[model samples]
Target chain A: METKDIYREIINEHNLHPSHHGEISNPTYEMDGVNPSCGDKIKLQFKVDDSGIIEDAVFSGSGCAVSQASCDIMLDLVIGKSREESERITEAFMRMIKGEASDEELEILEEAEALADIAHMPARVKCAVLGWRTMEKIFKENRQ
Target chain B: MTNIFKNDFEILHDDKYIYFDNAATTQRPKQVINAVSEFYRTINSNPLRGLYKWSVKSTAAYENARSKVAEFIGAEDSSEIIFTRNSTESINLIAHSWGLSNIKEGDNITVTILEHHSNLLPWQMVSRVTGASLTFIECSSDGEISDEEILNKIPSNTKLVSAAEISNVLGVRLPIEKISKRAHEVGAVMVVDGAQSAPHKPVDVKALGADFFVFSGHKVMAPMGIGVLYGKLSLLESMPPFLLGGEMIESVSRYDAVFAPVPEKFEAGTVNAAGAVGLAAAIDYVENIGFDIISQREEKLCRLMIEGIKTIPFTKYFGSRIPETHSGIVTFNIEGCHPHDVSSILDTENICIRAGQHCAQPLHEHLGIPASARASMYFYNDESEVERFLEALKKVRSWLGYGN
Candidate 1:
């Protein structure tokens, strides 16, 4: 894939002006994900309501465009999802990043399909999956 | 302009990519590649294990390589050279053998803060296991480690002083001779990590006053899995065997074993005979090119890169501003674009560069940067490549959507 295709308008927009690019106040769950090799770091914050539906999700950190934008886009997709639905979507996003998600899985992934070319760029795969991995870890550790 | 020596390297013959990551590893010349292939085809037997014709030839080739390395590094005796897998294994050998037996509680080990992880971590492990303190010799933001800092930091009870001759990240040369003098006065062994310096310049272990000098073969255009460790004869003889097994032992009974002498005592198991032959060929190739020409070409390329970066806005390079101090490495970052993005953008132009902490996280932490991008040139890299690199680097921010 050409560099332009990977850094498309949507990816650049999300990277430059991410809508959920801040901390959630009084967050119910907070976790930091780090890619040790490249030094990419993300602090994931979430506010899940009493019914286990994620009311709010945001992130703050320093990283490359792919990592930062991937996190912002991921939080946008999972904010209104229930704990179970978010988990399933996180799994699908991971699969999409790896280029293994089926047609139905890709449909469920929404805007995250923009990063499907990450599979061709193996070096940036970790950047594309940093948010989903962190969200998965947050749910796995803080079991409902 | 074309690199006069580029055609000698098969990988660089094609204009596929401009390789500027020589600090990580170098591409082997055809001479070295052919030498390795010749060794494998002619004599593939275990060196020191058999008495047949091919076995003797293999043993001769291995020992000849040892002699070449000793002569190349100006060691007094060939027996002082020990062949290992790489510089990491060589440093680990020192930590495990000499450090475990000699260093004790209340002692301190001094290393420069600019060290690559190979030189730093072994000392940390030694400090932890032996109850010794680990201290660092600090450098300035410009990558200068002053003589006063070295003097004050090495404690009176210091058992060893280890430092890199040239930093892999900053590309600054340390004062190995002065550090060696201080360590000697304090009764400490001076160890120099020559992985960076040996490839770009001439190194004499005796002139540097190093008790132990270690460097990797791959970084110097030799094949991987072969490294040279030069120790003072007296020190190598005194230290115990690092890896215990077949070739290193003179005799092995059910419960008792007498180890071989000097170099062999340290190199256990089957050695990389083909790798040694290839390294010898690489040494010959470097000698043919001569350090005078190598330094001249590298200095010119380094100056071009530093001067070019100055013209580009929002780009700053680490280390001393002087190009001579940087050897051939320039680690920099664009203000608005991340280092990974910069490297990826350069990748679109088929330009190769290094991006990350470079196995020196402590140095990165000290410098207050998370990571950096590095473009390290060798003699084979010409001025045109530097121009190409800088041109691509200038567009990195714009490609990432940062406006002019």
Candidate 2:
């Protein structure tokens, strides 16, 4: 896709009804994330069953459109997956976001392929990964 | 294009480079460079330690530079000026030496929300080390703090009032004279961080009524790694040396050691002779141009830039819009675009500017913004450069799909 198309898609997704937005009811786990360089913040929450599978995930916060959309997109990827499977997905997603994925791995991130254009713009990379980092922190803390 | 500083420095670009990142550091004049080269080529010897001819000449040159610095800032005695690595080290010396000795439990050290991290973090660490508490005086929406507000914040436990004369991020010109007087009324010593003010305008420590004044030489058009810390003679005498080594000692024995007096005691190691000479040359260059002319020129440039930025529909300026309240900086954010993105786009044009927190994160938090783009002017920036910057900013806004 063209750079403008990718940017337009991100901007549209940001302004339209974003997925995984709003608070989760009676969340079992929650974590706060902040981008210190810019003061952007997000609070992510999740519900996990006794089998360590994520039943649901939601987030609420204020930030740049890219950050909001990135989080919304990330929430759609991890719901109903086991905690171990979610970690593997997050690692694969990060590699794709950083433009370090193999061709076969690139096929896995279908709708998320638009984020590949963000790698050329260094400043927006943080915006592209804001939600993913927050989710990573949550799972890392859950294990501990 | 109109020449700001007589084209003394080459532009190497069109319509003059918008050299607005003055708070980070300044471009050196030809005179400062020549002075440094002359020092290295001719009198290359350490000061005060040797009695040879070259050593005596070098020592005299260094002392003369010290005297020039003292006179430039209206210091009562040149012996009260101590050279350090930069403003960070100068403030650190004060925090360690004076704070370690004077502050006790329950004492309060008041600073403001507009301070650079260099001024704020040192006091924060000092307050943590000692049992003292750190209090911050609130700033107005426009980034100005009233003298009355500062006075009101000085409780009975307040021991010091540390403030910046001009904020690096906001460009707010604080009323140092009034604030210093109020601090003195409360029996608290006032310290002024002159890193931003000293480069743009005249600085008279005595007139400001500050107990201590600190500034970096590089910010004032000299080379890096050299700065000045000026304190009152009595205050200097009371505080112990921060670092101990060869040059700062008066006499040493196996059992006992005597320290040198005031400023010499603080300057514990070999000094930056070339850097000091370059600073003195910078002072001479500024004096020759006349500070009143420089101040007027920079003020006019700032006004022009502010007016230009106001025309951009999506741009929201962060600090005081009143001309008198702001100095040479214009910080603002373009709607719908992050500051880092704005900075990257501007960089493609070789238009240097500072983005992100500008080392005043708390101020950004208070302003309810994540980051801001700052364009700070100097005496050398011309009006044509301001025009070019505005045109480029409009282009950037359109490119980001924010401009109609």
Candidate 3:
């Protein structure tokens, strides 16, 4: 497999200049994502409004382009999404990473479908899912 | 591709790929492979058990392998050598058998930051269990630990000093002889982790004054699941058995048992006789090639790699700048690129390199980085392989969209 298959232009752009790459003020839910195997870490935090809309989502940590870009793109998709909508997208993203999501199911993932190739590269599967897993943990625990 | 010994390894049949993760485990030569199979086909039996012919031959082959290890490392007697699953198990044997019983509260166990987790974590467990303080003897940014550093860190109250002869990540050789001498003066037992050094150079545990020397068979071209631990005869006699079962005991009466002597006492259960035979064959191969020729080739390849990496922009190779100091390992990083990404890019070019903390996270933390990429080499690696690696490494940043 070529490097282009994994590090496409979209990934490079999101990794180089992530929009929601810093912390948010008074986050409602936060979780730390750590890949102990390679030392990639991310602190995922979310700001949710009273009606359960994710107002802001940001992450602060160090990792590779796949991990960093995956987080940035995930936040871009999750922001302005309701708790149920974001949870559906999160499930689709996880399925895509595991190489199990159908095209119709992965439609909600949008740009994150770029990471579908990560399923072939077993080593980076952890990196591609680090942020998503952290977000899943936050949602699973903080459900009202 | 012109490496004279490369043809002996079947894994390198494909010229398009280069293997640079030797510090993790070296590829086994055909000679070692054949010896292991031959042992299984011809002398397959439970060693040191039963009075049958096959059992006798199996016992002799296992004991012969022990003698080969003792001779290879210059141990005074074969009884000093104990076969383990790997260096990690050997080091753990020392920690549980020797460290727990000897080390007490208030005593400090000193080790260098360059130690692999195999050498470090066992001591950490000993400290945690025994109430002993675990201290680190830090190396410089370039992986140098001077005599002054050793003298200052290893005080009179120190009870043990464990260190690796060469750092698996940095590839720089430590002053283990000096450190062992100091440990002796302070009445501390010195344990040398020779997993990296034993494969690359000639080592004399006696001359180094190491009370315990441990190494793995796989890292030296033997099959996995076999390792060697060489301890002083008296020291081995004094420590309790780390594992106890059928082979390690002389007699058992339900609640109480009579443990066997030094080496057998440590070896519990049925041993890996085929793995031992492979290791013995590997030792023969190393001896035939000799360290003089091996060191010269490795140094030449390392210098070529270092000089090539120097020309790459926004790149920094860790450890001493001197090529001779690095046995055959070069760990480096490109600015803004994670080591995991670099390793993936190299994989695209059919090159394999280690991209992690190399089981030495404490050293990575000491170097002020989360992780780094390492390209370690064995004697079979040639200059052509080094050139290919450097060429691929140059494109790593660009492949990740870093501006040239």
Candidate 4:
């Protein structure tokens, strides 16, 4: 029997009261990631400082509870961190969701680590990674 | 098709899962399952290859299945039936083959707002290659297609018109006969995506005057890897081969090649003979009870389903609330819950329904919804399933914490 307990109270709490839910007035970088098959889209908007630190980050769009919560949690993690630190955290979170994270990486992913059980549901892994993948895509494009 | 067909389906007897995703695919009857197994066990040979007994026997089974399909849909000739992978491939074949050759720059391709992406995207590509303009005959908010829109959207430059006989998402039965007549008057060909209609009602391509009709076998009762593209014999003969190689060729040399007749020319490579056999068995199973029984049974279930959905104040039914108009599919959204959450909540009860855009993205955009959940019923489904679905649906909002 498959378990449906993936929607823990923490995920619901984040979905209900998302801190990073709206769009930024003006942003340094913006990109949209969509699970084209399932219709989940998260547009990640970020404002970076001159010191290569992310000043503010927000996501806008509609998606499932998990995706909405994941975006909210993802932006909260990277808001005040340097680009270098945010990249490491996002990498750890992605690894954690994909079931490949080490103890050190899981330690870096505090609230986001709640989705670690999501790796068991292969169909939903994309929902947990939409915001992070969009950030990764924008970083690659900016680097190029 | 029969009232007792639930027993014929192995899943119903062996499992407790309630299947409401019939629009995606139906559970196969024991007959279809056994026919496929019998084909593999007895006539295991590459058809249309060798002149041996096994090859001849397999070839006969494949052609016999074609004949059954042609007869099932009221086609005049068996050769008009071209086996494809699924409805998507069948429509793609028409676009790549017929659309590429006939449509030109400055031509217009007309379709309804309710087409599945399978029916919409191929024409999008055809327009791209041919430089043809595309137009849509908008449906009403309740998903009704009127005659005025048909007359208005299809004009002098309209080269080809395609519409689904029934909308997979909205469950709206389009006036294909009316649209086909307008298309004919304007010297345009009519293509009907019968993916949703063929399985639910009696479909006669000639009576409907469709120049081309496409449907998937899996959606009806057959296995995957089998689809049917029914075209007028003249049109199939006029179009170029969608794929060319192997059995599709009459004779071939290094430099030059000659192609076979209509159906064979379109069907390249070794065909899905076993899948065709399974499809024929599925047709036999559905036809055994006939559309009268199927439609009546499904309509009653749909009415019960709609009535149950109406009890939820948060539920917003996307199409006609009247069950007869739905033709057995119902798509809806709860007030404060995302469709994924609605479906996930239902999944905990082992109730299988479809979620997302249902591959009709343009319709969802027009409806101002990001996605919706769908419960598609079939003749095999009973009234208790609908009651259970309603009971589960009512809990969706509360499960997502909408309850105060």
Scored by lDDT, the top model is: 3
- Supply the global lDDT for candidate 2: 0.82
What order do you get sorting by TM-score, best first? 1, 3, 4, 2
- How far residue B27's Cα lies from its native spot in candidate 4, in Å, is 0.7
Chain A TM-scores for all candidates read 0.95, 0.90, 0.94, 0.92
Pairs in clash, predicted candidate 2: none
Model 4 scores what on Cα lDDT? 0.88
Deviating ranges (above 4 Å) for candidate 4 = A1-4, B1-3
Candidate 1 local lDDT, B159-270, one digit each (tens):
9999999999999999889999999999999999999999999999988999999999999999999998889999999999998887888888999999999988988889
DockQ-based class of model 2: acceptable
lDDT of candidates 1 onward, in order:
0.91, 0.82, 0.91, 0.88
Predicted candidate 4 versus true structure: per-residue lDDT over B302-397, tens digit per residue: 889888888787897889857888888999999877787788778889899998999999998887788999999999888878888898888776
Model 3 TM-score is: 0.98
True-structure Cα RMSD, model 4: 1.9
Residue B174 lDDT in model 3? Answer: 92
| lDDT for each residue of candidate 3 in B1-404, tens digit (9 for 90 to 100) | 56678888989978988999999999999999999999989989999987999999999999999999999999999999999999999999999999999999999999999999999999999999999998889899999888788998899899999999999999999999899999999999999999999999999998888899999999999999999999999999999998778799989996999999978998899999999999999999999999998899889999999999999998989999899889999999999999999999899888999997899989999999999999998888888889889888889888888778
Candidate 4 lDDT over A1-144, as tens digits, reads 133456755446778789988888789999989988678888888898788788998888888887888888888888898887878998999888778999999998887888888787676788778888888887778762
Preferred candidate (TM-score higher): 3 or 4 = 3
lDDT of 1: 0.91
